[model samples]
Target: MSKLADNLNTILQRIKELSELNQTSVRLIAISKTKPVEDIIELYHAGQRYFGENYVDELEKKSNDNLILTQCSDIRWHFVGHLQSNKINRILTRVPNLDCIQTIDSIELADRLNNNLQKQSKILNILIQINTSNEQQKSGIEQKDFLSLYEHIKLNCTQLICQGLMTIGSLDNVNTEDESDFQVLIQCRKELCDKYNFSINDIELSMGMSNDYERAIQVGSTIVRVGSLIFGVRH
Candidate 1:
């Protein structure tokens, strides 16, 4: 088969092996941000239905492309980037088939997206991004504010569905398998479920990337955003 397909299979096999070892089922999201639509189509044809893009304009353009529309209609687009409030309407309007957004980090952003989705009578699935690394530059809610944002969404934002939580682990500790961040997320999920009476199984944890996904799966990451490992490094 094609090189891309082969590469995808290798990554999937690794994920499968790791998931089996960890006794956890993990869903893979191909992060296709800067990659071409052709590469996306190749992976899609190879049975990859979930794809992620970081930029709103790129996602809008790619999702609207005739090639994606005709050939990969079943492809699920995920907005896995720091979504600015101004661009929310454009994204909602342009990418109709956009599936899950895994970067909701604030009540204001969540409210804005919910309001935009309300206009279209759509309930967008969202994951609250947690800054587990506590890095100043990272775009996620502080551990303290996670529940406040979640509660705001649940209480006020009717058009947004809170699916779970997401986090980008510390890049500095990538090789060490420092699962402190993952542990924080797991504990947060457990607390939320116990305190709010939410279903533990319903809350998904979106953590891990190309470097530390195996550790993430071992600690109960339901969705893993793998990019370079499957698609090769972006130029």
Candidate 2:
């Protein structure tokens, strides 16, 4: 088998082992931003269907390419970066098969996307991004504003299916397994589920990355975005 396939399998196996111990199923999103299409195809052929891209233009090009559309029609594209309001139309129009936007952090962004999707008679899946780390530089809704934004989406954004919550764990807290950010997400999920009369298991948690996914899974992360460990370092 190819090295890329081997790496992909290793990550899957690790996820399986971890999830089994945690008694929760975790979906793996291969963050393919900045990587060549060839590499993405390699992983695609190896049964990796969920791929994430961070940039709008790159995702548009990759998803719109005749080659990729023809060959990998089943590939699920995820937008895993900060999304701007102005680029919403560009993304919604260009990438017809975008499965999920994992960075919806504002009521305005959610409203725009919902309005556009309503025009197209489409329903888009989205996750509310939380700035669990409270970093000034991150592009996520603060904890204080999370519920209001979530309520706004649920009430007004009829075209959006609120999948769950997503956040990037604190970089400084990674090595020690602090997972405080992750814990915050878990608590939020529980609180939201209770308030909404929804099942806790149904509220997905899109946390964790290459460095701390295991810890994330242990704490109830339903989705893990892994990039470097599977695709090798970005150039």
Candidate 3:
């Protein structure tokens, strides 16, 4: 196996260990942002099924790459960046294999996604990104509005499925013992379930990246977006 495969397998093995300890299944989104499609193909052959991209134009081109289209048919794409309203149609129409939007931070974005998905006769899985750290520069909704956005999507957005919640948390607190943001997300999920009468198991918490995914899994993160550690430093 190649170095890429080695890296991926190592992460997968660690993920397995963490999941086993936590008694929870975790999905790894090999973040392919700023990397070439060839790297993605290598990882796909190494048993990676999910990949995330951060740019609309990049995702459009990569998703349509002939090499990728022919080789990685079962591959899943996730938009792990800010969902700009202007680019929604581009993402919906161009990226046919998109599996989830892990950054639905506003009701307007949700409504537009729902409307566009409806127009395409498609239903999509989405995660409402919460600014659990309350960072001004982050691309997520404030934690206080999590309930309102969830309620709005539940009531009005017929084409969007609220699969889970996603967050980057605080850079300072991620790998440390702090996890206050993770706790906030856990609390938000509980509050949502409590108020809406939905099962807690129905919600997936997407919190974690390359440095701190193990801690995230320990705290109940169902999906972890890992990049540089697997794909190597981007050129």
Candidate 4:
């Protein structure tokens, strides 16, 4: 097997081990940022179709080429980075297969998404970013403000659909496990969903990175964003 495939298989095996037959089924989004097209192709060949890209340029470059078309087009593209309103059009235009955007931290961005969705006549899927660790440096809504945004989005916007909540665990010196953060996000989702009377069946919990994905799965992470594990460390 190729090195990429071997690495992916190892990660998958670890996920299975950590999951331990839990009701939550973990999905790996092989974060293909900074990696060449070949690495992505190898992962696709190894049965990985969902890929996360932190940068718009990289996502466009890889997903646009026809030589690797199936690995790009047939795959699901997730935006796992901070999003800029001005850059929305570029991403929407290039990454036609963009599945879910995991960082909706502000209502203005949501407005931009809705406006663009109306212009393009497409419904964009998104996740509200919750600052689970309560860290200021993190890119998510403060715990106190999440519900207000959730209510506003539900009541005001019809173009952009909220899939669920996403969060980055704190890098601060704390004893909290990755699963703890993941569960906090899930709890936030449950509270909002119950209040709004929205169905949680189709919603997703886009938590976990390379380090804490196993714990994320144990705590109910439907999608895990793994970067360095699949592509090696980016410089």
Give each model's whole-structure lDDT: 0.89, 0.92, 0.91, 0.81
Candidate 3 per-residue lDDT, tens place, 43-100, comes to: 9998999999999999999999999999999999999998789999999999969999
Of 2 and 4, the candidate ranking higher by TM-score: 2
Mind giving the per-residue lDDT tens digits that candidate 2 earns over 102-164?
999988899899999899999989999999999988889998889899999989999999999
* Clashing residue pairs found in predicted model 3: none
lDDT of 1 by residue, 79-162 (tens): 999999889888888895888999999888988888888888998888999998899988999988898888999999999888
As a whole number from 0 to 100, the lDDT of residue 175 in candidate 1 is 80
**Global Cα lDDT for candidate 3:** 0.91
TM-score for each model: 0.96, 0.97, 0.97, 0.90
For model 4, where is the 10-residue window of minimal lDDT?
A: 172-181
Ten-residue region with minimum lDDT total, candidate 3: 169-178
Point out where model 2 deviates above 4 Å. Answer: none
Please give the lDDT score at residue 11 for candidate 3: 95
Return the candidate ranking by TM-score, descending: 2, 3, 1, 4
Provide the clashing-pair count of each candidate structure: 0, 0, 0, 0
